[model samples]
Target: MRTVPVAEAKAHFSELLKAVEAGEEIVITRRGRAVARLCSQRPLTAAEVLAPLWHEPLDIEAPEDRAPEPVAEWDD
Candidate 1:
């Protein structure tokens, strides 16, 4: 990870792209505050993006087992 000011980023755009291609993430900062990240663009299709959220409703039902019998005590 590396931080570069907006001016530097604009001046060395190709170098930044090369750095990103080499697996380095560059952060663009404005006034020493990080505002954006530069890295490889991985665009996913809408279906690919939302596929993980598609699932049947999880209908969890309570068990039907009978309750335990009450305890019996005998007094002599």
Candidate 2:
């Protein structure tokens, strides 16, 4: 982890971004107080968000004889 003043952070913004991409944590301080943090953006892996709802394959075709009418008819 690294801490830098606001001025230094502004001066070396590109370098700091590269460092963050390499898994480094950075803290931006203002008047001796920590105000902000910079960290790498972590992408969601396939397993994290793409878990299958069902494992077995099943039929998913629309019925040919399905009625097109609504259950309740409303008066216009």
Which candidate should be chosen as best, given TM-score against the real structure?
Answer: 2
The reply for model 2, stretches above 4 Å from the true place, is: 43-76
The sequence of per-residue lDDT tens digits that candidate 2 reaches over residues 1-76 is: 7999999999999999999887677999999999999987895455533445557656688868966876787899
Please give the lDDT score for candidate 2: 0.84
Least accurate stretch of 10 residues (summed lDDT) in model 2?
Answer: 44-53
What number of backbone clashes does candidate 1 have, counting pairs of residues 3 or more apart or in separate chains?
0
What is the TM-score of each predicted model, taking all chains together?
0.53, 0.55
Query: Where does candidate 2 clash, by residue pair?
Result: none
**Total backbone collisions for each predicted model:** 0, 0
Model 1 agreement with the true structure over 1-76: per-residue lDDT tens digits? 7999999999999999998876567899999999999976765467655656779645689999998999889899
